[model samples]
Target: MNVLIVGAGIGGLSLALMLHKRGIQCELYESARELRPLGVGINLLPHAAVELNELGMMPALAAEGVETSALHYYNMHGQKIWEEPRGLAAGYPVAQLSIHRGVLQMKLAEAVIERLGAGQLHTGMTFDSLEQDEQGITAFFIERGSGQRVSRRADVLIAADGIHSAVRRHFHGEADQLRYSGRMLWRAVTEGEPYLDGRTMFMAGHQDQKFVCYPISEPLRRQGRSLINWIAELRVPQAELPTTDWNREVPAETFARHFDDWRWNWIDIPAIIQGAKAIYEFPLVDKDPLPRWSVGRATLLGDAAHPMYPIGSNGAAQAILDARCLADRLQEAGAGAGHTALELALREYEAERLPATAGIVLRNRLNGPEQVMQIAHERAPGGFEHIHDVIPENELNAISIRYKRIAGFDPAMLARRTTP
Candidate 1:
């Protein structure tokens, strides 16, 4: 069976690698003429790490990114709300990695090119549309270099093309629209001294206003410094959507002033904001879960299927999980499986992932595990003598565990899935 993958982002690249490992024929088409290391940091939860580890990516990940030690939540006053061990520190089989998003994509692309050969990965191709029949799916692309239309026929077409996926637009059209979260996020990286434990990820404030900071560079950490990746999120008054481009740069003054008083004993928020050479402004937005991610010989994956808030660091992680699940289902469908068998496999993949991710999408809207911070803020707007006084220990622990289970990274659940 031949698989045509749209977009060379994290999900598409990962699916290609997994298919190759299963000895399946797959080709990756990327809209970008070149795959450059771009974007800021992203966290890889244990479940996502487990999938990448299967592909022998842990070493590269560890070398390039920080193995996160703990996750902490704080109130606007910088008072602690909740803290918990994370990654290997949390006793999972693998460590949660915090790495640069662009670097991670390039690493996955490198693996795709090496394992599947350069010929299998095509750049300068933008997905135009697709048509599927009983025999196979034919996808059309505009070759960006020459502005000519090109078509590729394959047994199945997987769209991992992200939130603005053309394939998703083709199917859902105007019905599929991004729901703005009324929050704008300024994302960037800053070089500075390490914070708590040198490998901690922390978030301050509630859903309306929040500051998230985590070191994302292993090289800098080893040198006794840090490369902090942070997001200063603020609630925008406008209910209408703002520009959603990932690379839109803006001055720190746009949102940094809101976090002016975020400095605490451990870290200084203003300095970190000032340190960034470039800050990207993006509104926090997500698409409502689709009723179906697959139709006949075509299916959607990653952001193309379920674009959720990045609240639990599950954006890329969920995408990776989707690739693993889809690849496993396709492999089980058998290599020479006809279009009928392949379509069933796609539906099977959809049945399992669609609802699971949709739950996360809705849950994230409620702030997911970060609900602890929200609860604390709501109960104690001034500050707290003790976090438990505002929010009980049991409540905090329950929120964390529940979110972990929902995100598919519950330690016990993972052990069960991988224990054989």
Candidate 2:
């Protein structure tokens, strides 16, 4: 079956590579005139890393990104509340990757072109709408280059077009409006001395006011330099949603003042903020989970299917998982399988992933695994002499494991999953 994929972001490109590996014919339509490396840092949990490893991408990821060793949660005072070994250090088969978001996208895009060939991946094509019938699917796009509308026919259309997906807008419409969480985030990268073994990810403070820091560049780390990616988040006073653009640049002064006193012995939050050359502002927003992500031969993936708060670093990981699941289901359906079989494959993928991600969406609103940080803040707003004095050890471990299972990355779950 010939498949049409919308968007060339992480999810779409991953799906393209997965489909090609299954010997399926697919083409990608991306809105950008050309794909450019963009955005800040993101983490690839072990479950997601397993998928990438199967794609033979672990080496490339290791070369460009740091393998995150541990995750630390701290209160506003910078006292560690909880710490857990992550990725292979945590005993998973693979390592969790902390990499630049744009670099990962570019790597995935390059793989798509190499495996699927250049002509299969088309840029400057904005998805406008689509219509599905018993025969197949027809998708219309506004060709950005020529200002002309064009249509393509395929047996399936998978929309991995991200949070602002036009296909999602067409299907879900009014029901898919973004729900702002009253939190704003300032995301940027800075070069500096590495903190905490130079391969750790740490988040300090509660949900309202927090500072997250992690090293994202392995090469820089090896050179005794560090490319630290950080995010300073705050509970903004605005009730309405701010601009949702990911590339919206703003002065660090917008949120830096709140974290002014966040200096600790090991890491200096203020200096990290000041060191950033550019910081982008994004409101913490997510859409309510849809009842379903498939309509006939058309379906959604990644942020297009479920946009959640970035509480657990599960955004890109979940998208990679979606690509794997959808590719598997589609492969099982077989290329010659008629439209009815194709539709069933899409539905099967939805049935498995829809509720799974929906749970994460609602759970993230309540802080997901990050709830421990919020709990510590609630119980000890004045700070505590010991974290266990404020919260039990079992509670912290339970919170972490529960979120891992909810996000489908529990060690047991991953151990049971063999490479596809």
Candidate 3:
């Protein structure tokens, strides 16, 4: 069966590779003229890492990225709240990898090109629409460079087109489906000396104002150079919101004020903000879980299927999981059962993923891992001489455990699961 994939981002590329591994023919269409290294860093949790390891790309990823040992939590004043071992350090089979999103995308794309050939993965093709019949699905596209129209017929079409997916609009219609979470985020990367344990992921500040910083590359410990990625979130007062664009630049000064007092011994948070290369601003947004994602031989995947809040580092992981689940279902159901098989597979994928992701989306807004600081602030009512005096050690441990379970990273869940 010929499968057509849209967008060629992480999810699309992953699906293509998985299909090739299964000996199924597939083609990928991307809107970009050429793949450019974009975005900051992304974390690959053990659940997602397990899938990529099976693909034999873990060693390369490890070489290109940092193997994070633990996640650290702190207050705005730089007081340590809690720390926990992650990935292999946490006893999972896979290690947590933190790498630039572009690097990860390139790695996946290179694998697809190596196996599927160059022509099979077409750049400069913008998806316009799709039509499906009993026999197959025909996808319409326009040449991005020349605006020339073209069409291709495939046994199935999978839309992994991302948050503002055109295919989703075609199926669900352009309604007020996307919801703004009232929190705006500013992201930037800077060259700096390694902080903490060199590869630790750090979260600082309170819920209303928070900052997450982590290393994206293997630390040059001798040279004291590392690629640091950071995200600053603030509650905006505006009732109406702006469109979601990854390239939108935000003035660093607007968010840097919150970190002025953060004089941590390990690294200077305020200085890193002032010296950032560039800052990309985006409002935290997500869509409500849809009842279904499949219609005939056409279906949605990744951000198109379930756009969740990026708080839990599950965006890429969930997409990776979707690709594996979809491919497995398709491989089980041959040509004659394609339509029904695709629908059933999508339903099963949603059943397992929707509730889990929906809880994460809502919980991220309410009480994520950073809530530990919130409790500390409340109990102290101002400031604290010691964190333990305000909050117990056991209570903090419980909070971390709850978040792990909700995010599908708990040790118990990972031990039983075979695939992401």
Number of the top candidate by lDDT?
2
Residues 1-420 of candidate 2 have per-residue lDDT tens digits of: 999999999999999999999999999999999999899999989999999999998999899999999999999998889999999899899999999999999999889888889999999999998888888999999988799999999999999999999999999886778899998889999999989899999998999998888999999999998999998888977557864456699998787889889999998889999999999988889999999999999999999999999889999999999999999999999989898899999999999999999999999999998899999999998899998999999999999999999999999889999635
The residue pairs in collision within model 1 are: none
- TM-score for candidate 1, residues paired by index: 0.98
Instruction: Give me the runs in candidate 2 sitting further than 4 Å from their true place.
Output: 243-246
Q: What is the C-alpha lDDT of each candidate?
A: 0.92, 0.93, 0.84
Where does candidate 2 have its weakest 10-residue lDDT segment? 238-247
Clashes of each: 0, 0, 0
Provide TM-scores for the models: 0.98, 0.98, 0.94
- Candidate 3 local lDDT, 1-420, one digit each (tens): 889999899999989988889888999999889998799999998988988988888998898888889998777777788888988899999899999999999999999899899889999998898888877898999998889999999988899999989898899997738888777889999888788778899887776788899898874533568889898888887645675555698788877887787776788988889889799988788888777787877788889888987876888998898898888878877655656676676567666766776777678776577789788767764667888888899999999889889877788888888644
> Model 3: residues >4 Å from true position, as ranges?
219-223, 243-246, 335-338
